[model samples]
Target: SWLLQVGPEGYIVLPSAGTLEVAGRTLADVRLDVLHRLSALFRGVNIDVRLGRPRTFRIYLTGQVKAPGALQVTGSPRVSDILNSAALQDNASRRHIQVVHPDGSRELTDVERFVRIGDQSMNPWLRDGDVLQVPVANEFVWAEGAFGRPGQIELGLNDSLLTLFRLAGDPLPAAEVGNVLMLHWKDPFKPDSTWLRLDDVYRGTTNPPLRDGDRIYVYYIPQYHLQHEATVVGEVERPGTYPIAEGRNRISDLVKAAHGFLPTADLTSIRVHRLNPGAGEKDPELDRLLRLSRDQLTASEYVKLTTKLSSLREDYRIDWARLQESPKDLDLLLKDGDVVRVERLVPSIRIDGEVRHPGILTFQRGLRIQDYVQQAGGFTDRAWASRIRVTRVVTGQTLPARNVRALDPGDFVWIPERPDKTAWDDSREILTALAQVATVLIAIKSVK
Candidate 1:
């Protein structure tokens, strides 16, 4: 076996054997000449002669073909063979396959005619750089609204409503199977629509064929009642709005659906902000106070009235702790537009300095400075009880421990180191030393 190259002059130049002129010779002539020459040199020996490097050409088959691209051919290939290689798509036009030649000339071939009638004229050999385009079928329709898989679906030349419905995955459960609307867009601004009963079409009563650019919208059954939905936010594993089904979908159920609360969630008081339907309704006593003549009352009385009015507008806070204690309250039904927020636990108070087990302790109501000091294993020997301070989180005020009644959340409890002497005692000792030095100076002057 040897490799050979055909020259630009259309002849193969062989190095081992003398060059055989094949410019005008056919492929059979070249093979026969090689075999005869080998047989003459070695008599009664088997010889195998094969042609190599036939003139290669490429042609492109695009649009609605299974695999559209340039196809390389060693020899002239027929249109049927090229189309078979490309594997035309289902929506490809069978009667309008166009072949555009490199010389700007075009030819239309009916592939279906060639396949059925064996018309050799419709299956001409492809030329180099020819572009074969298989256009998509013009009859296509879009199916949207209440269909399982709704989108623009290409249709066959004679596809009916039944075929289009099956392609769109049929009508969904919520779809009104009795009424289906088909809109034909003959004009861009105006579209003609027709209502067809899908139930009738299913029973083989009347199946209408669809045209190109037709849109089929399946209507849904009308819903008269409202569907409830609630949202849960903050300190939960999954926080989002969830639809409340028609059942016992209470606060606990909503919380469980959100994958429960996080570790840092404050179980003490979970806030549920509800929007009341009668929020516009006012209390008679509050309305009376607003209408009262403020100019007739003294300045102090008017201030008291204003304070009472402001307090009346305050939102009521639900005690989640009490609700958690009562089993019946946990099953309380939730309403639509309700926002349940699980607040994060407050940070523990920091207690560092002279103490046996100095660290932070979880905040609790009614915890005092002494209680926190005792919880930290009491104070050390050098602990200065008089210099103990508390930094309040509310006002950000660092005051003496005696001034604070209770330890608030996020408060810093500090105990300073005990001093050996008081400031007044050090000042008195300095004054005594200065007096002794002055007396010593006066006695020396008297001796002089």
Candidate 2:
């Protein structure tokens, strides 16, 4: 019989054929080192290991082993000793026994199976130099870092090694402290969800759970104020500024604010001028002056002018019958925040009976009879319109009006409704009367 065993003194071997006995400490240490190294090779292989009471187990050794089987171990016997003991009991193949580990790992061994050795039970996954680990039952405490998070930690009965991380990078521009966010997997226990305020986080008051795959997110907040308002000018009772409520600052609103247009307002010829953007003050003023002077530009030209003004302020536009027409027809919308202006056309009387084409005349400062007659389309053929009869409405008096007679804004002149006769008798009489009056005035002036 061949005997294989290791005691306090070391390994002792009894040879199979010869009565030769071998004993040595170095030999035993080397044997143990080899066994441990072999175990490491199978570190992660799955092995059916029964953690029995004290020192017993019904272990299944399989996968990667030539002869896989189940065996009952007892009395602090190592796996190596179990295989060797099985060899002594049956015709077990010594080369078939192997070590298997948790990670589907395995290792082949050629050492004699039937051997009695004492040290400690081998952890097939740990190498000879590797420290053997005993799992110390830990209390279910809050664990953090790479392992457990802040809210729920797993406390070991003794101590443990865990990896951890920290808050990094610069704070984003919009991130608010009150609602700092963590975009992570939803906790199954808290379906309602949870969030942490920045104050709590900064003060370390709240220990929000930060698991392995957790990330923090930051967001921004919104802001609001009053945006825009307008002014009224020209032909109004009380032209001034007023508050512009939302969706209420239109042309009609401006007119209403200004107490409506005055009685002298030219409903058909109303003009609204606005400051033109990209146009210098001098240029816009000059343009307006030119339009006022010419007064006969096409609607297109007027539209262009309005567009120029609109560019400066979107609220400026013509606020009369013209505005009712299309913008192409020189009408435009009044923009909010614009100054509204109304211009009153000059008022004057018309002359007709003996004029070329009795037309309306415009009144100017200090306008005389000759100027008014000339502006009223001049005199007709063989008609003495210049020899006018000025009647006073209040006194009902007729004055012998002359060419240089000064007229008021609403005064009238009768060109003596020409008499229809074969001879020019009445016409001559009217002219002679006017001539006599002119001569008298000249004589009086000469005396003075």
Candidate 3:
């Protein structure tokens, strides 16, 4: 739609509503007036007044603002509405934003206070024909460590440690408020450092006024790095992250702490996944072996490479049954960020490709590859039975028929098929027969 601009003289002229004073008034207040003015003429009508478009006006942007000129702005915008990190000059003071009214009266607003605490008073509505500016900040105090907002903060009038903390969005729970370190730069040459308890500042016991070039460090309380913990998820009674003691706690301890496994939990298939494993640790031999190609590797090197790739990875297959029998030997000792995944029971082996009834068969102990193939209704005519491969679920390794002696419970047997001969293969065979016949005729003629 159409726009009704709020004139500089503090009113919006309408055809029906006449002239309504919109300055210093919300849209709701203006809308109510329109309803009252229209009700006097019409018997009963629905009056829906929506903000079609915001009015535009120019304001003086002087001082330390990046663009210190007359800037055109629309709508009833606040101080922060027109300001961003990029809009300010490098050393511009955000806390001390000066707004000079048309009457030559000044009002100070802290842009950071509004952002940190959401105090509407700190971010006032912009008026037309006002001089807005942010002075070059000469006094700044730095805050670091466990604060919600930690950086260089512009010092303001009557600013204390409380003001600094408030402007910094308060200290984190891990902050050592009992001992806050401050570096005072009273003299340009070197500096004086002191430690003060924040509790004393709150109690009005020791609150010294902060100065320019002062850097305060809010140290985090020790042990904030966290202890060794493991996360147990999926099919567990209580799925969550639980802290563990390195030598004392085992897989069983973690399971007990989690209130044991759920009814659907596959105890046979539970795994302990260590975080990163031996990341950042150097293994020259292993690294060299892993980088080498298959043909470049020796027999011993290939064995080492395969072992490292499979056995030395992040996840470890747990022997939950063996752990129960011999807890001291089989129970895994979990470290920090270790994840214990427990999945639901799946009691069938899958037979795929070149089989008449290629589907899942109920897993049985002491079953071989042939037994699984028999269960899947033998094989199709095109089946390459000799080149069969079995995939073990426990180790997730695909083994050839020669390497794989017997099938495991959760093994997947894949019987591949022979590819059909194309038209090119038939043509090549006929061309070879013709060339052989021509060669024999030439040989016979030479003999004659």
Candidate 4:
């Protein structure tokens, strides 16, 4: 043997046995062939051979490939490894890549199968001096509605509806499989549609062949995935989520379904928190007015600001006592995601800020704002008495004491300490109250 080694050209020169082609062939297969030829020449002794280093060579990449030309790869690479080096265009055919061998025989590889289904068989090892022809993809199909991965997919020549659906992931539970809409273009100018039963296709039924630019829409069943439920907690007998028919279910109906309120249920201050209330588009006029100081606002703008604030989603409270008095006018229609919190009876009013003794006072139906303020040691000398506000605990509605005549049991009477507070400070305080109370929309008009 003439100092044999696996050269760049991938062959070994034997003095008497001649040359042998080894590149792209399996190392184990090449080892067997080498040993067989050499064994004939050198007999009566055991022959041992092992690969010292992996072989690397250049492979030609042409057609529908980015940076098309010879791409250098090393060490017994597969079709996928070479593909990684030669980035193919989006229009390149991933399902029918031709790997043309040096001897002119070619093998078809499916990169899509290897990627989507993890089918290793579809990805074959590369041969040296092989030419990869990444043809332009011509077929395409689309899938949408009630599908996990709903989008357009590159199609192969023999790909069927089943193949497209399989690549899209399993249909959602709400998918109306029997009525899956299939739209295709029979006439070049117009499109036609038909329904296919996907369940049958999954079975023994022949999967329909897909045409170019076909669309499959798997629609969802009506109300199949919808959940219309609300929560009832606190002093309610059953504190859990219950389904409601929305418009048909009233506050009383929901309460009755919860096995009525508990004995401690505060009938005078039952609160209903509508979780998903629609917040309308931002009002630029209202926004501009709010940013200005109270003195900067015109009389007409002040009126506008007050009117806009009133139209906002209010703090909703269902007084069982008031509803019982006038059921027709007071009964509220329950909505989805409404939280009916039946608080334990606490016949006490909270008197906070600027009060001599800020604390809870006994609730009396006849007591006015002044009456409660007097019981809580009255306002301090620094108190902004005109700006004193009563915040409805259930609805966070803070109003001037003059606007409120009699106070309820779960009410917060805040007496502000007189200050040269900026509009930003008052606005920030009002925003804090809104977040904490859930729907508090008190006007911050005391800008100094």
Candidate 5:
């Protein structure tokens, strides 16, 4: 007589239908848990099924997408359909549809228009949705330098996609092609990758289908008209002012653009002496030292001199000794307007106190710290061997007597108090005091 019954273990029993137990899965577990808690409160003759399959698909609209956050989709759909249903973008270019596949590859579909309304003979040079554009035809061009062009007419196509005719004015300056620009399209109707030069594009290069919402950019390459004005001085084959184009020139390029340096020229010492714009307001102090003629310097020269002085006080510095030891220092990036002076290397060190020839001796390149000591006259009779210390003035770093480190610029060699080993006890006492002093000095120096 009962249409349905409740089982003790949270299950639904139907007299006509088969028994359905809460199988501890999906809604079953929830139903069982819920019913098990409320079983005593309800004595029901009919069973109620509370849960079933959801009616929505999980979707997330984000980024430039109009609809954002978690969303639900109902029924089968395509990407276009989903976008439309969600109103994803306001200005979405249907022609530029970009679909991201599950495997992460992207599909770019560009829509093109070929045929026009009254097009006959298959619309000679256009496809559907493509706009007809008027072409600019001209047979003459003008530019400067060795040669110039008055006008030149274009003939039928040759093997070349485009041909550049010399314009009348001056012979085309070497490497200076005048007014050549290129236009680029972001999206073309055809699914091929082909580009045309500006001259050709303006001249109706191809009949490729043009699409809606496509963009084109124009780039120009001006001939080096200024080549005759640019000059390379110091260490170059032709060291003088040479002309170059306005923009097609750089220091490095100009170096190669010219014949390069002579065999005697020092490449590392080469520098650009630009016209100093501020040189007219000469400082009396600087002019006295440089003794450069007024005509020889420009405003830029004075400014550079001032800057060099400033750098000499600060950044333009090198602890040649440290640099020699640490090769990394040599890799410093040189800045424009920087005057790199490669002074002749004069190796020398000062040895004070003790030794026979106790004066400053000129040291040669690759001279060691010991060489300087020997030059300082190899210690007086009372000179203490272990008491020697090399003090670096620039870094304030001091090396001990026994440390065989190389001598650096601004370093002073100090030969300390002697250690007399004539008597065993006296020598021991002196050595102990010296060792104690060295240890204390090292410890005190550590905090620095």
Candidate 6:
């Protein structure tokens, strides 16, 4: 084991060769002496000697590299190796790199050439206490939106749209190559704009020149332009606005685009609400309502008239029955802003009053009042089946149970409780009936 120390003159002192005599020597000389002594001591025997820590030296890595600092590197490291460790920035200039020595001597390293041509001479071994300065290249244009690597890109003197696209890592899939916009600022406030077709540029049909400070914007493809867009809302598997391409633009297409109808969707009635071309046209009926005096009509009547007029002005609704009967009618082209509404299926009918299971039952077609009653475990013992009433949902009219052959969705069936009467109750009922008859005769005489 041999010990080594640095002298005040910045040199290492170690035992000379294999002898005990100490002498100051350069790092290269010390390694050579040790190798010679080791070979002589053991002929044809390879020995692995671990080299101790080398003299600490600092190098400044500034400009266009990540983590610019006074880096401490041991032994002689090549310029390429140092840059690899420091990590070059995206905009770093690899072609015109400079190494400034402590004694003010300068050396140019063409790192780009070394990287491309593998010319080791271009990436010379770095000397201790050297300053590695990377210069930034000039002439750049900004690329924004829908580009893989969008930012400021360096351009050559004769660079064009082709060069810019390549430097920006090309357009993304969502980019609209046919609608790229380029803007050149003439001054701080004035800009000259030009629309470009990158598809044509890429095809070499045109090569538009790009100048410094010019901004290139790649537009994303619009949903409508890429496909005919129609909106489907309510009671569908996935209800939302959908796009239908050239061969796919139809009513069926829109339905498929919406992922089909849900189980709760009303298949019998689908409404297509279209944007009316005459929407801006004034209606004479609405004008008439507007001219009416508010004092002449009650507040409720005025509101009703206004709402009815508004509905008449809106887009017309097409029934789903027409489309269902003729599926080919689905071939009808869907325009932009057209809204297709699939109504939700009506819920079950309600059955209350004296029944074994008095609750709601699922609505089915051609269901009679007795059918619902049967579903509810039949009428209770006290139920007056003859006095049962059926309420219509649309008309809100209560009719006799026997008159209703089938029940509509949302209809209510009610069974009344039977009246229990005694002999005294019969006498009181006869007296009440006579009093009603006497009052009716008196009212008729007064009207006459």
Best by TM-score: 3
Error of 2 at 26 (Å): 95
Rate residue 186 of model 4 by lDDT.
94
lDDT scores for all predictions?
A: 0.77, 0.48, 0.83, 0.82, 0.45, 0.75
The clash count of every prediction, one per candidate, is: 0, 22, 0, 0, 51, 0
Model 4 accuracy (lDDT, Cα): 0.82
In order of TM-score, best first, we have 3, 4, 1, 6, 2, 5
- List candidate 6 stretches off by more than 4 Å: 1-140, 144-163, 171-182, 186-189, 192-212, 217-322, 326-364, 368-448
Question: Residue 139 CA error for candidate 5 (Å)?
Answer: 68
The candidate with the higher lDDT, 2 or 3, is 3
User: What C-alpha lDDT, on a 0 to 100 scale, does residue 264 get in candidate 2?
Assistant: 73
Per residue, candidate 3 scores C-alpha lDDT tens digits across 1-448 of 2367767788878666588887788779888987788678765767667878777888888888878888899888888887767888888888888999888988897887777777677677788788887887778888898889999888877778777887887888898878799898878878999998878777888777888888888899998866878899988889999999877788888899899999887787788777565655788988998788999999989988888766557878885787789987888887878899997877789999999999999988788778888988999999998888888777788888779866656778899997789999999999999999999999999999
Candidate 1 collision pairs: none
Give all TM-scores, in the order shown. Answer: 0.39, 0.24, 0.64, 0.62, 0.22, 0.39
Q: Best-fitting candidate, measured by lDDT?
A: 3
lDDT of 2 at 407: 58
Give the Cα error of residue 172 in candidate 1, in Å. Answer: 2.3
lDDT of 4 by residue, 1-448 (tens): 2346776677877556888988668778977987899889989978766766665778999988898899788887788876752588867888789999999998888887677767777688887789999888877899989887889888875878888887787588888868888898897779998878978879848478888888999999888957788788899888888988878888888888889988888887888877534446688888998998999999998999888877775347788988999988888888888888888988889999998999988898887888878988888889999899889776678999888877777899999999877999999999997786653333343331
Best of the two (1, 5) by lDDT: 1
Model 3 / residue 50 / CA error / Å: 18
lDDT digits (tens) for residues 1-448 of candidate 5: 2333334454766433445665334666656654554455556734455643323445444444565565556533334444442453444432233444434554432211111112122222111121211112222212222333423222211212222221122223342233332222454443333444433433655333333222222223353332335555555555555445444445555556557645654333333334344545556767564777756778988777667555444223343345446645442333333332222333456678666676667756577656776766576778777778887544455788567456654467877767555688888999999999999999999977
User: Which has the better TM-score: candidate 2, or candidate 4?
Assistant: 4
TM-score, model 4 to reference: 0.62
**Candidate 1 structure quality by residue, lDDT tens digits, 384-427:** 98899888654456899888877756789999888788898999
Over all chains combined, what TM-score does candidate 2 have?
0.24
